[model samples]
Target chain A: MDYALNDFLMFTPEVYLRLFERTHLALEPWFWAVPVAWLVMALLLWRAPPRARRLVPVAMAAGWGLTAAIFMLQFYAPINWPVGPFAWLFALEALLLVLLALRVPPVGIGPVVLICWVAVLLALSLMTALEAGTWQALALPGVTPDMTAVTTAVLLMAWPRRWRWGLLMIPLLWCGFSVLVLWALKLWWPLIVPAAGVLIILIATFWPTSESPDNA
Target chain B: MRLPIRRRHFLLGLAATGVAVRWPRTLAGQHESPITRAIPSTGERLPVIGMGTWRTFNVGNDPVLLDERARVLELFFHSGGRLVDASPMYGSAESVVGELVERLDRSDDLFAATKVWTRDERDTRAAVAESEALWGVGRFDLMQVHNLLGWEGHLETLQAMKAEGRLRYIGVTTSHGRRHEELERIMTREPLDFVQLTYNIADREAEARLLPLAREKGIAVIANRPFQGGRLFDRVRSQPLPGWAGDAGVSGWADFFLRFIVSHPAMTCAIPATTQLAHMRENMDALYGQLPDETQRQRMINDFQEI
Candidate 1:
């Protein structure tokens, strides 16, 4: 028999499962704290003044930084060697979030898109929690590529259109890559759930908008 | 050829009539010679058992893990192993092999087999260069097109390289016995020195056509996934070794599975991957003792099926 494309992959689905289970198992005590932080950010986005709400990205930045340093670099990178460079990219994404949060320009998306994106993130968290069989599994949500992609989608909604693509670049790319990895590992349900969210954000962002006169 | 035969017969005369001296006293201080087979293309002899580096040797840049993997290679060589098969797709296995061999300074008897994995000519050329650099070797003994990704194009380059004295042999590899028809087509036309494919007690489909074809075409066969990626062990882990296995001189299930594989007259070698030292020894031990003849092999297969 000739070799199949899957034969070229370095790892099997078992390897990925082991890595994820290890990472989640290692983050036991910190799991509850993740949801608390997210709850606070959600409240600020819903109830705070426009200027105060600008600081929501501050929480996003902090979450991403912690995900990069504590979750990815410390926990995941050692087992999966290729993830080392990706950990640094997560750090860079954290920095970018911090810059966007501080700049706080006139940035807002339609309420409908915001609600839909938030629903996607919550569904992702629920699915992960159900799979892991614990709410504590939510602690390092940003560490998971799907959660990170969700965060990027929400952040893009608040950022101006011109800046959206640049900020969306890394997480979007990660979503695509994770889809392949998940597919190889045969984690069909988890991958399909997040893939749907990613598709929605991609369609919304790239969908042609009616300009001052619909030039095209 | 005639002189080597006389020398081989002289060595065999000193041992059992059918047995060859596998490890000379100066080499490994052993009594019974491990079984050896001829590569159909070149008539060069290699041990019937070899080491495979897939997930086992891909401990990328971790010094401690690299040292541990090095120990595995050391044990392989010390146990009279010659062929170490790996591929670029195995993460950092090629580099790990290079590091261990360079450190042990045991490249002389090592039969290094690696693969070219890309499709584009420029990428394939660069990939070969990178593999050579990672292996820290001047020449590869066998270079196979990995999974036939760009087999035709890479075959041309491999042929050219072989002509230029850059490589000793060219071949192709596959796993899980996925693409038999396409591989059979290529095998019929290509002047391949080797063909690597998955074959284990559980996955004996290769015995139907591929093995016989290799025997006919004079292409050496390298049996991979000999333990069915650890599934065979899981199946037999709790079961007692068949009573007759001891009489056949197979010590453990590993040896039983491996012996069953290499016992085929057409089979060249069985390359099994393992990281643990004890497992490596178990795998190497399969090279020793009496290989079951055709009837015994059929009985062994039927017995395994009953399990």
Candidate 2:
């Protein structure tokens, strides 16, 4: 049990990064639909009615499902054994998202918070592409785990305190796991993942309920 | 470690006078008989160069990488390698090796060796069965207790398997210079056929005790991390090889580093892992040509220290 972090990581940074490019290649032509899903989610979150806004979590659930199936199970599990259990965790998160969508009331998130979340998404996508040294390897929200976790955490912050804490479990777990993996790979730029997770937890806990209708 | 004045003067004289020693060159498609060493327990001989599947062979299910790694194995066999060592701890490497070995049809030539690495004693037989299913080979030539985890129970099962004619060899392994005292105690108490630990020019701690113990106990020694997980190359990347290195058939750093390890009397073979065909070729080249004698090994140690 006294194993080093590098002992669990069998592949090199080069091989790990190439996984994104290989994933992109595997989903070619139909890959265009991924960005389209992102745009639709953004538009629905920004302008839709309160009842329609419930679709946001439903959409996020789809993102989690895709990431678990395509990225974690297909591309990563082959190289890293622990990723197999991680894929099941993601699938469980997707099921939880569906439950949240059905049971929880939709909270009205402000335009400012929505815009900041979108900015965070775009910045993460660009940073991932730069790290991979290719635009084609961009880790978009629905197609990759890191961005999907970040987006899900931010969206879950709009819920009431009890629901928020329960729903944030998987995304937080994933963010912490991602931080260790990136740190072990010696890549500094991708630490943005856990940072964003911390920011979401802070905003969800400390932001004044009187100032924002979403916290009500 | 002081050198004899005459031998020192001869080496310095070669350096000072710039005497060019002809290094043996083995080109691709040219076959030279590889050097072999006898297993201590049984006189069955294995080539000095064996293949290791650590980070290199864990390429997963990618067709392109599978084919590429298959070609690397192909080159290894073409260069006269037989023993291939793997473990269940290395993700997907066992399955990948099994698939590639079947594809190349080299199972007959392969001296397949793998390890049982789990904390549960009851799971040892199941783990070996899974490995056999993955490797597609009916029986493994060797099965080791990786890192000495659950060693007592696993070793008992392995002893039974050997007695049942289900396995040819049983041994224990540790790497990165960890747990040497425990390994030493096991070597003394257990009836092991082989004892693998880290041995290289950089990490010579094994030479002090475990290696000498292995020699005395008539146990075969497999040297893992012969290049110190590829860190030794980084140290000598910018430095030039000694002028007299070619006199011992040292053409490149791989040969220089590897020859120094396998040249030891106690070492049965050194398993070096590589992904590229060119690097595999360089590693296998160490199997051919003359190895450094006792004086030359010290000279190699001296040269390495200066770097």
After superposition, candidate 1 runs with Cα above 4 Å error = A1-9, A12-59, A62-216, B1-29, B122-124
Candidate 1 lDDT score at position B55: 76
Q: What is the lDDT of residue B228 in candidate 2?
A: 81
Cα distance off (Å), candidate 2, residue B212: 1.0
> All models, DockQ values?
0.13, 0.38
TM-score against truth, every candidate:
0.69, 0.89
Clashing pairs in 2: none
Q: What shift in Å separates residue B153 of candidate 2 from its native position after superposition?
A: 1.4
